[model samples]
Target: MSCLEIMPKLGLTMTEGMLAKWHKSEGEKIEKGEILFEVETDKLTNEIEAKESGVVRKILVEEGETVKCLAPVAVIAGENEDISGLLKEAGVNGQEVAETKTEEKKSDNTAVEAGPKKVVVIGGGPGGYIAAIRAAQLGNKVTLIEKEELGGTCLNVGCIPTKTLLHSAELFSEIKDSRNLGIDVGEVSINWKNVQRRRKRVIKKLVSGVKGLLSYNKVNVINGFARMETENSLTVSKEGGKSEKIDFDSAIISTGSVPFAPLIPGIGLEGVIDSTGALELESLPETIVIIGGGVIGIEFASLFSSLGKKVTILEMLPFILPPIDRQISSMIADKLSKQGVSINTGCRVTSIEKGENGLKVDFTKGNDNLNVEAEKVLVAIGRRSNTEGLELEKIGVKTEKGRVCVDDYMRTNAGSIYAIGDCTGKIMLAHVASEQGVVAAENISGKNVKMDYKTVPSCVYTKPEIASTGLTEEQVKEKGIDYKVGIFPMGANGKAMISKEPDGIIKIIADKKTEEILGVHIMAPRATDLIGEAALALRLEATVDEVVTTIHAHPTINEAFKEAALAVQKRALNSVN
Candidate 1:
């Protein structure tokens, strides 16, 4: 008798999982407890072990294919056993599903319905899902297509997860010093597993809310890999079923970015992982060596260091937070150094090697060759736009440097097709992507809108969060703009001082002639939340005098903003100018 293996439910809330990789080849001898495959669910990869010993007969699901729970994905049987009937019963020929995925191009000749436009959005990230909801709100029939989980990278592996963990770390740090505030506290240690469990719960709640929104807005969601069959048509492939053809009057490609991996030796080694892997690690390694000192690495450094983990950051550049203002970047590096984070900027890593302890990283700075060893290595260089499976080139959708090319209105070369979010490589932030999604959806619904990049804010959620909007001082200098700089330390703010979180500074740049706010950069607590004011000021083209005269409430962190604005004209009250 043959044994059928289906996609098992890994969690109560997981309706489906992506077969990330098969650990064993077809026809390979199987062991009862040996690893068989990996299933990605809840943003974590879980190894699915073989339940019974048998020769593998067939693998029905392909890698990257998403399969629903309880769906037969493979078959194993005793040698010489009749498996044909079982295969027939399971409806998994493998070849049949493969054939359906390679079907011919679908023509965009569907009869137009008089009621509403038919819209299909691929990739349910912050961008894609938001676009679907907006389109539906505009009286369009919307279908959202996602290969794996919704909420995309931001909710799963990127923004939400990082911030959640950071909050935990911050709370732990706060408790360690509670006695200083005259509060009696006993020993408190992080229940790491509980922290992990809570992170998962938060994510599940938010994802369910997003899905609920989609349902309420009347957006039909297809869970499968989508490939473009035509400008107005797509072929979605499921793990254990025939391909589905979806046609629309318009489409959106929000398929976001994947971690940019360099071709260095030993990068594929056992303990070397990417940003997503770092987020899902079950336990803290004794020490971690992170490559690249960009926003991702810096945030991770903040996270592990707060928990008293040994962390070393290696960067090829001259400084960390490369895009930030030079002086503020230097300040952040110093603060992180004070936190015991070993930062080696201008250190070019030539290769990573497996070491006796864990992993060895070899690099050189100028004439010096150096190395560091740690329990794990994280490659956090950056991200690249995901555009492979969409088949953009086949339909004349233009792309530059592997990113989908779109105009100000998010329209691709094909007028009926559009792309947004990380895939377009426009500002690779979730908020930016969400705004772009709105712009794209509005344009599709017969509204004219263009994305304004000038006021878009970028934030880093490290200890003493960093944020910026508009032109940096260096950029203004390069543009030959006449600018005046105002600076105020957070320690000068009464509210910040009282809260015991007074570390870092605020720097504002204003045009000397126009007195208009050219930029606002901060390295202070809750900078991510505070940057919204700067974004709005830039959007409204507000001037220094306007902010200074706004009469900020007393003993509030926001008063620092007005003080910094006053410093632009050398009239600061609470702080010396």
Candidate 2:
């Protein structure tokens, strides 16, 4: 039988890569260790070498096209050997390859759905809009309703806006330290107005993009608040006393979330603002006190501190980023402290009061009562699911602690009703919601799709960004799994040293008995982008040896991930074992 040559995983985090060039054509003889093709990822391009000596039977994947990691890109065999089965297995028919699995599922679903369904999705956020589009693509008549802006909180006031500001903050912080990199640029200053303007521009562009996508998908979008009267019927009320009734065979609720405001005294004061208000600040404060030490709070702390604003964070939890791996969280805390951000954990905010300087934040740490004065106080405590006016109860849809309840398929208790995203309160990240939306839409389209949270990646957009996927060390211990850990410091990475960003580490944890990779945590430059590969690893149940054998491009930050995997077996080449 002819052997298949697949697109090799070039790095630990790489799920797919672009076929940049082909060194060998069909029928060309190639030897082991000879360059076969070049693959390009966001990090770097690497020439992939052949593993077995053979004549290239057929080039399955063309250059400039992207192929998934481990998917057959070409078939290699000896002269006169039959390779028809290999090409068919690679989804090659003549010169055309198969469409994506999602598209294939849609085609199957279209065949299953003898008639189009009137699918209604409430709220135009990441979850709602995605579900609406997917439902439409699955040959359904889909309608989406939202009172505020399209793209919901994430695009309007959450992820997009916050990341935009953080990018500016990171730029300013980097330029200030650029002299150390032999770039002697003097007089670094932040133009706050321009920063805010750019943030708005980015948000506007994203919101417009979402609108365009909805239109292209043929999803009917309504600008109003949706209230469910029955499982199959709802009413949408618009501004200026306009109302319309919508009847559908199926419905998806994706109302998203709102920032939770604790009942601390003076929380409603002028200077005390929630995350939404913080994003809309007219001017940057000289000093800011952010209450909460979760992802949102830590990101804002990074933003303000990087811009030379005095930043203080108070958290009721014993530690910051409690959901993250303890070691990674501790490292981030240390870095934030070094950057002059004061993080006070295991503290409860008593009150916010007006003071001589700007605003006084009073909190207690154990037996000590402490106060910090700042120009503005931001409440980043957390968010609660936004199910207001949804009237899910009217339709007998169950809700737990103000969040919609749903099954793995995102179906609600009420017949033909589904819920996704923050409204369900199952992992509040936008990406999670989007996936849940897909699950809900596909299920509604007569497909058996379920949402999986096992490999969801959590990201923190701070200096030396943090991202993690799969079980944490604590969770693994609680589950009583015997696991081995590997750690690689960025100080030893060539790219980190060249970029002067050698202040993070990549950690990998795998099952000792089976060598299955259980978790991957990273706090390095481009860590957010790097987590995708880790997520794919977890999804595919990749083993430590699998990661170690993957060829990582030299002189790149991604090589640290491979080194970390090697460390799992005490055999890391570039770092101390």
Candidate 3:
């Protein structure tokens, strides 16, 4: 029998590895432990050596092709051994194929079998896709059912597409502001059609990538709407009147959430839309009124304002980003206002009416009723969990306030069933959902794993990105935990000064008794990347003293993190005392 060399899993988090380069080709003699291919994982890149002393009769995967772990990458056989049949069976060739057929056999066997545990995951959004991939990795048969697109709201209509447009908007704003650095250029203009086209292209690429990943992991992708049939089964209905009954030992409901539209007269007027509809960008309106001053609203406000549209934000709360530190939020609000964005806080949209030329919005500020006019109205209140279609009661899954309830292990009341992501009603972040998905999978695989929300980070992709991990100052004060605050402004950083884009701050909270870092918050350019150190610091229980002692690279933004720790003890190097 020929020996099949499969791509070995390098790490727990690594699902697929790229064949960076092929050292040996097909029909070549290879010795045992000889380097055959170099693979690149998320953490690192390494070479895979041959296990058997024989001729490399087939190379299943080629350079640049990212194959899943444990999937066949090559086959070795003796010189006289007949390997043509094996090669043909495995679809081996010199050129790399986008996807391999090995996973299909595995998925078919697992899905059709009754002995192995089966899992039907609803919705192919960020949460759903992650859960399906994790379930498949844990040796369970997974059928991921999606109604519209694989990535659901986040990838299809929400986060991914919106971010792409925001990137364009940001670029446009930057080009216009290039004169600040004495770099004068021609007049900057934006072709809205081209911007929309680029956004669509990005969305298409990401959606295809997600589909490929699911296929590589042996996760069966079903394009349909899924509703609960019973506690242990779900019925997926396709578009062409065809339906399949999926029997599952357990089910992970990751249907995610959708934008919640408020009830008001003329709210559904021609020019009025929700966040998802606004992302279409059919045409940029001259003026826009964005209701709700939350993350979604502010994000849209930033994008539209940057695009040279007159944008007004109506916020019912006293401040935007109410969950964040008031001091930090006020700074961001001031920055937005300086950019010509109007923010009206402590105001609620009572009603909207369509005028002859534009839309009229009637809002109330306490006892005063105010009227505003805009070309388009956008409702950005919040999202509601997608728990409507799936009859949870029939399946014995308990839900509260339109959200599925799961324990620390991500398991629902229905013993074998699990719930994750937005449906679980925990932290609604994509990374948090992905982590929960893995925890659910591990639990199903007989491994004792639990979801850790304490270390989960939150990020807002605004002008100066905001990222935070761990407890907030309010929580610390409320709990009466003796904590020391350390803060460092970006203006003092050498890199920030050189870039001429320094308008942010980094704050660290540490336990006064133990000196252990309890939380870290940052607002700066590429603050998302800088938060990793803080996250690791909190995860490893690194104390403020340790962080301060660690030598950071000079003239870098990361030095701010180290300096902030030094500021905790009133020993900052750059701070003017």
The candidate that wins on lDDT is 2
Q: Estimate each model's TM-score.
A: 0.80, 0.82, 0.81
Off by over 4 Å in 3: 1-116
Give the range where candidate 1 is weakest over 10 consecutive residues by summed lDDT: 104-113
lDDT of each: 0.87, 0.88, 0.81
| Two-way lDDT contest, 2 vs 3, winner | 2
Q: Which residue pairs does candidate 2 place in steric collision?
A: 13-533
> Can you write out model 3's per-residue Cα lDDT over 528-557, one digit (the tens) per residue?
788889888887789998998899998788
> After superposing candidate 1, which stretches have Cα over 4 Å from the reference?
1-115
Candidate 1 residue lDDT tens string, 1-577: 4688888897777877767678888889898888988887533788898877888888887664555677777788887788888788678544444343333112232111123589999999999999999888767899999998999999999999989999999999989989877787999898889999989999999999999999999999999999998888989998898799999999989999999999998899999999899988999987999999999999999999999999999998999988899888898899889999999998888899988899999999899999999999999999999988788888889999889999888988797898999999978999889989987886776544578899888898887889999889999999999999999889998888777878888889999999999999998878888899998899879999999879889887788888889889998888889
Question: Per-residue lDDT tens digits of candidate 2, residues 265-326?
Answer: 99988899999888988888999999999999999999989989899999999999989999
Ranking of models by lDDT: 2, 1, 3
Candidate 2 TM-score, C-alpha based: 0.82
How far off is residue 172 in model 2, in Å? 0.8
What residue pairs are clashing in model 3? Answer: none
